[model samples]
Target: MAKHGFKAIEALDITYVLPTYARARVAFVKGKGARLQDTQGRDYIDFGSGIGVASLGHSHKALQKALKKSAKTLIHTSNLYYIEPQAKLAARLVEYYKRGDEGKPNTQKSDKSKWRVFFGNSGAEANECAIKIARKYGQKDGRYKIITLDSSFHGRTIATLKATGQDKFHKHFAPFPDGFVRAKDLSDIPNKLDSETAAVFIELVQGEGGINALDKKQVQHLAKILKKQNILLMVDEVQSGIYRSGEIFASKVYGIEPDVITMAKGLAGGVPIGACMTRLIDVFESGDHGSTFGGNFLSTNAGLAVLKTLEKMRKDRTLESTTKYFHTKLDSVLERYPAVFSKRVGLGLMCGLQVRSEEIFSQILSACLRHRVLVLRSGGNVLRFLPPLTITKSEIDEGFTRLLCALKELKISQTQKTAQKSKNPK
Candidate 1:
């Protein structure tokens, strides 16, 4: 054990690891469900869920069992061979897409045979695959431009980064891959579209972009327009999929059938896996795209375990009830601290509380950390909450209790600072 707690680990990381992230001081060593324990042995209520990747929570029994079982057997093999776990996992995802299509009288029932899956290692890879499909599908017609909504975040790779609609990420990455256009809004999308338009990719709930969920009616209308024009509609469900939006996919919540859907983050309950599911399966030939580690034995089995657990939750309506309870808790918090919070944004367990300003957000975030509660920030001024799907009511209550204490402490500190400023008059 290190004598200096996280400081020793921090020193080693700073020395050896690339400094890509401005990390918090704490170093978590263990976690269970909605709670985490730091190297110092201090407990914390986890609301960030590693930015919404731990959907089934940390060290879940199902995931552990699957990992152990897969490790004892085979960890990976070439994609050339038919992997049962990978095939099963892909079929399961397609079934989920089909399940969302049920009971819609006006909509055509999803044909399982029409859809196909491509496994990858991250959301960026999945999104890249989706973009490739759109580009390839449009190549015959010379249409290659993909329209994305402003404030949207796609991924970090060169292609996916170009697909991101935010300007901040565009800086420093010069000469990005072409064929991506940004639309200001639904109205502007029509103006942005032309003969070169191949697809309109969007996140139903913009998780990293301040948790802003697009209006359902506008999205439905956009989908209709895109379909009429023979343009692909891609949905990036990396952060909002897997019951994060109270549905298997956020696209289902919006009631729009996307031509391509990309998912990662929570798909395998913390295992590194991503998937690109598309109806246009013929767009990519066998040699068009491949991943050496994609759909490996361990990852696919982990995904299967996560799917099984989530299926049970969906069947028992545990996911539905929990989502409702979470929203209710958020509503109560917003009501209690009207002045501190501007509004609540997002859907289901994927939520954000907009603060009065960025400074206030930073203060509250630091206070939350000080109070042994781990949270996240998004879109500069939003305090994002992405607790595990398995977070219980009592855990929610406890988290809120710590949050309220942080708010009170902040209030007191602000009052003192005001007094000091008045006295100093500098």
Candidate 2:
């Protein structure tokens, strides 16, 4: 690559691509494990993990082999016939869900025959499927409303966008699909629900809404209330599932089993895939819902590989040990920079540091990028960290070392700016 290689690529993207994402100024050409290499050959420790999509990290051997084998055998034959990989992957997800259900105390025992899976291409699609199931289940009683918590994010599609509780996302799209309402807080849920209410959707650990985890007791109580009312409970695990929260699903961490669970992001370890798992098997009948490329061989095979790898990690306690080590390092950083970081938020690997202000957050983000440590930003001035579940203690140490240096640089820069402002005050 030339000295101006990234600039050339950026120029091409500006010309051809939609300006939807505020992309960083670097172009990564290669990656291995938790490290990525830019066109300039500089390596960066991947703490963001492509916004929690690259669960197994980049170029994982198991995922690569599975993809290769599937590509050679069959990639897509539509959903007309039976797909072996898709069936196997669904079974694996069901197995995990069942185990999670059985491990918890006082929870309802899962009926394997009553549970089912629906495949899609993204989190939005999976959530859309869940919404359909809720509507269908409630149609007999004339119920269609789905209540969502404030600061929740579902997706960008019309229906899911309406389902998102954030007012910012509701802008620019007029007259969204009806039947979705937002609850100000957990306590407001019952007041909002009526005979028309069908389900309640939530993210146990709100990801884009500042990495905030809901109160466990409140969530459990809400689950019991919904169960007693016969209203469905849907969990959006799009960003917190697949061991990102040190558990297979964040719902398990909260000790509640939702009626509908929608997952994606890290499911296939980078391949695009989404799944909607539900306990209400009879909600959708034949010809009710279908996807053309939902259960294709390529995506499902990749999903199976990720499932196998994560299963091994779970059995060996690799996820547990790594999550503990990462949080410990995070707490050390927070303790050392109390003035910069107000507090630590979220659970396990899906965590964040709430900074002093949005300005400080932006400065720290830029400084970290300059120091070649990738991170993410969330709501409420948070520096979100969604590292790969396979990240090592050494990688954690390396990332934090650069992060501390970035913080120091930001402090120096801010001090200089303050001194300059004092000198030039009107």
Candidate 3:
């Protein structure tokens, strides 16, 4: 960790107890929209978007009001009672993705049944529920193996860590679940499938896997193959859902319907809530998987508010068009610095730029911090941009100006080093 000049009390040694995060030096005390203020009142242009959780931006009034009102009314009831907010939120969510008419829905629906929701408190928990459902779905047929892509990222839980395709996350957390298999590409999946295979899980855009996106054909083909094999299709949308990818869900852009969808992060506008919404909601028994605080009154209220705001943003074209404009500006800026950045990849606001090396990324990140612009590194060598969907053109231009100035400084530093090396005859 790069040490910032903040003094710490010996009593505040909790950081040593928890795992270390690649955190910035400055401490943020307040945030609004796309701007954050540090302890010393220095302002920063936030491109991290709280790691893709603040879709409506920090401290949104809608979310705040909902949270406060719900808190005053009721916070937790242990899921024993029929919580009105939870039921209402789930109904709203189902209506958003419900197919056909109410009585004559689709093939997945039962004659007398409705879509069901299983909620949790975080992305990992959401994924854990999906994993459990998939396992049970195939437990009868002896099909338990899960096929994930080479560069896909799911979550940090034991099941999700095993589901994660990158080998780096698998270190030391050995002896993961037995039914997981990693594939180089979708074609590699066919060879790995057997009677023990249960489902295929993937990230539409591999956020931690360098922000690389699967080809539309690759995804569609995988979905087809999984359907043929009776293997469930699970899309991990924890990072890509809730308008982060311009669409409400990344699967919409890919033109595929997953059997199960896991969503979190932006679901509640920074409040902790994760959910597994699936067409096959009846696969698991009632006691197979559950959570105590999953769909409590407060979180559900916040989720409803968040969804309403996003739906409004989507209809008004404020979120999607703004994100598209910002992406275009990013591409134009990157074209002017091709030597420093080779390529950029992403969909809408969920974007990443691949730098030449980890060293370059670190240098640029340090420079961004110095200039009071906050950004995050994704998939080792790419700088991920998760700016608020509500950010304006002026904010984009200002952030880009700071970023370009940092790049220019790095370029000059490299040139000076080359000149010094020539003079020293090394």
Q: Write the per-residue lDDT of candidate 3 for residues 29-107, one digit (tens) a residue.
A: 7788889887677888989888998878888899999999987899899776788988888787676665332323355
Model 2: runs farther than 4 Å from truth? 1-4, 100-109, 412-426
TM-scores of the models, in the order given: 0.94, 0.94, 0.91
Error of 2 at 77 (Å): 0.5
Per-residue lDDT tens digits for candidate 1, residues 1-426, read 235678888989999999989998889888888999888888899999999999888889999999999999999987989999999999988877777334222245455458899999999999999999999999999999999989999999999998898989889988998899998877789889899999999999998788998999999998999999999999999999987887788888888889999999998988899999999977888799999999999989999998888878877888888888878877777766665676899998899888765656777988999999888988877889999988888888899889888876655346645654554455
Candidate 1, residue 283: how far the Cα is off, in Å: 0.8
Candidate 2 structure quality by residue, lDDT tens digits, 232-295: 9999999999888877888888888799999999999888899999999888888999999897
Model 3 scores what on Cα lDDT? 0.81
257: Cα error in model 3, Å: 0.9
Query: Which pairs clash (backbone N, Cα, C closer than 3 Å) in model 2?
Result: none
Estimate every model's Cα lDDT from 0 to 1.
0.87, 0.88, 0.81
